[model samples]
Target: MSAPQHPAHAQVPHVLAAEPPRSRPSSIEHELPKVGKIVFRVQGIPLEVTLEGLEKSFKSHFKRSNSQENTIDTGLSSLVPCCYGSGHQTALIQFQPQTPKRLESLAPGRCYDFEDPDFQCRITIDQDFMGSTQLYPTISNLRIEADVVAIPGINGHAYGSWTGASKQNRKTMWLRDFMRKDFHTCRTMIFGYHSALLEHYAHTMSDYTEDLLQEVTRARGNAEEMGRPIIFMGHSFGGILITHSIVKAWISKQPGRLCGSILNNFKGAIFFGTPHQGLQHLDELLEAVKKNQGRKALLESIKFGNRDLEDTLSAFKRYCQETKLEVVSIKESRETRKATKGELGELARNGELVMFVAVAFSELKLPENLETTAMAEGDHSSLIYEQGGYV
Candidate 1:
């Protein structure tokens, strides 16, 4: 598919100088670490503080020291914590070269009491462990460099969705193998989150967005191509998460210390089998849930034909216009147990450039205003595996 023409809409120009010079790549470049991760278990995690909230508090910890002229070296590439279980919190902090001393200060057998206007919380560090080094294979020999971050859909596996499923025992995972075998210079990372669609509890897309923002900030430290372009790839519901994350960052005024680099440097996005326009298949899903007396939250969440979708796409389009972002929308082909709404063309409706591709078995009718291409023999997931289909 050739690139879509830039839309003739009101312009939102980007200010090049507004971005920091340090955020750009330097002449002297260094390769990213082969493999690295560090984790700590802290008890007495405040119940009131969500992961995003906790991350904000942690950022404050660094800002305060920097203001005092006693800057703490906090070089975490990503700070992702396991689900709070029994009031105990476990976080995997990925970094490059070495772990941050500020994090190390949260050592085992240490206790800290934090006070605030809203609430006071106490933390007891129980254990700390150095993450293994051989989790991911090395790519230091690659010539080109790009940060490729993948986000899985609802109830999807972070590693499995891209690497291929475990039980099948496939010799090569799509993402890992593709990058390793095809494009040696690309560095890949999976953005994982809790996306169970039918949970008894309630969680909005905004919550998931915040979770992704936390991971993006944490991963920023270890990015091999920090100054280079970043590709935000999302599958199914993962697309929604990416959209919300950017909007959330914008809403927060692009706080200099929180995911500002990601927003500034993000150059492109690839959405797979995503329901950018409401999920037309949702009516049947809601019907089934209504018959079985499912949770109201789930019902309300998937209700189609809402203004939320339009509002989000509008914001995304505005950002793309400002940054000249490249967007690729891929729809599924072939029928499954249930159909998913896959009208994602609007993501590129107002963008300067876009590649709209459709996989075989997909019956989606592309908008007449946009040019689209079809894959001869591919399904929703298989399309991504195709060479040059995603890259």
Candidate 2:
């Protein structure tokens, strides 16, 4: 036996000169056992799943678990409360009278944060855009959508008041109709439990971190109690938040004691359009960053992330830290998308958890009127919507 053989991902040349092969459709379709129930399709598959909270939190911003307890301000949550909903929309968002559950102004009865051992996450999306006109009208309700699928944020009973009047009957659901008599014959169960990215967006950065850690911890606790896989999935901005939080928690040792506390329970991660490198839409991201300049206040709140994104990812790959991570990303490529594909392939080859998936976006056929789509953009952001376009 000569030296140990390197895996294909390691032995292959960088091959940056070659363009990525034309992508094929991501034939992987998501399904569930029951049509509209919270039961897992495959009993043995796994029970634990988490769509991480914001990497930034406000309420839990100043809270600390310092052991030295000798000084003031040694442990605090946040100096200022987080703008979870739109801080501007004072009317649309409000916290519970005596609880941390942030409720929407429209649906005060709905609880954004609740504790239950039965389910690891209870997502509540309030996609109510009050601008009078909606940007993406294709979505249903023009309200909160789970996983970017264009559906209403109605609670309970899939067969909801599909054809009923509003206010009088709010039990109707749109996806239930699609699953009942669809041409594709897709399983109705996949749409069973709601998607986990139900962040109301009013959490402080620290609160976000702590909540994610709690989710991870809850997943592990659930696993220990029931035994299952602890998985996390994020897209776009969510992807960034998850990545940053992992580094901050384990590698940098910023917020809490994640290195020893929660690392053991982590199974793996699955990210769709997460930017491991940085912002894809540099202009938009740059503007967002600029508006958030000198975020010393915000920066101090984040006890996770390795100073930045690149450092966090690199440190993770090197195993320099331990956190809620086993796999980093699972991405799909459209045939002719302008974004980088070759780089994604390289990461997949590395023995890391990156995998290559294919998908068709918009069903846009080129000049030849091809039957299958290869040319597409990053559609992972919108994979789970009811309308089923790219998120």
Candidate 3:
């Protein structure tokens, strides 16, 4: 079992200095310790981006000629459902030159300093997917350098010049995707989510749904054996995923009969912008709509259940019995136009749920000095692309 450690909370003091001096981490960079090392980072991105868009980000400019690859096998065979290996593990995957989008333009800087052991094994994606769980094999004398930043948002969002949040009101953000993988962690993770009745994942009834539990388990087991600490990172949809995974484990009521697929317990978790108690405004609105005009009227108001973000919040009350997991929430700034309804407060009060507040700041104007190269980040710029390092 990993020893319990306090949150490594960091705050960059706003400095009025002339130039931000070049800063480097004093500690040695983390290398994926075991074979088939997997790093899973979840990101909330607009739907416009595709697998192809990702193909472009890690190629030619991102790393050297032989840094990444198009495909690599995970050693696990066809029968094992969870194991996955990107064809491009050593060689960077490139985008078609004819494509109009120049992905690097999304972020201000094209040159990201990748410092991890296998710096070339960085995977770029609009959304952190099942393919994202793998770590590059550093044993091949992979010289570590600058950080391989996963510029978030859709391929368009990366360079499109629009920032706020996804229209879906997604609970995922930057940290999980772009940063967590930089340091090698020894743990396993399982993702779970209850079906949203009015939304995408719904069955004929809501009595009990163990839909994606098995797949999430297989994925974690693959990552664990490969030498990465498995963390079940969930958003509102994924929050439902983890919630149900644990509930299934607790329901079996056995010492070892886990939630269908998770091999054993997970090391730890860090959830950002998730709705644990449930979504407030939408649920009330849906309820009000149900009370007034019929279910049909409510359906029209909600974008045919797609915009009904509160369904997951209602799920906790409807399902899930385990309450022992330590969950943390990262809060949106007060400057947000649409305010989040219920907040679980700080870690001091809720031992299980620690909420981190993210404040958008104006870019600090610097008078340019050769002494400092630590550039100031735009208020809404993606953390992975902006700050670019471990916590």
Per-prediction backbone clash count: 9, 37, 38
Task: Give me the runs in candidate 2 sitting further than 4 Å from their true place.
Answer: 1-207, 218-223, 226-229, 252-261, 285-307, 320-328, 332-380, 384-391
Ranking by lDDT: 1, 3, 2
Q: What is the C-alpha lDDT of each candidate?
A: 0.45, 0.27, 0.27
* Each model's Cα RMSD: 15.6, 20.7, 16.7
lDDT (Cα) of model 3: 0.27
Which of 1 and 3 is the better model by TM-score? 1
* Cα error, candidate 1, residue 49 (Å): 36
lDDT value, residue 41 of candidate 1 = 35
Q: Which 10 consecutive residues of model 3 have the lowest summed lDDT? A: 72-81
TM-score of 3: 0.38
Better of 1 and 3 by lDDT: 1
Query: What would the per-residue lDDT of candidate 3 be over residues 277-330, giving only the tens digit for each residue?
Result: 333224333432343344324234222233332353334323321332233332
Give per-model TM-scores: 0.52, 0.34, 0.38
What ranking emerges by TM-score with the best candidate at the front? 1, 3, 2
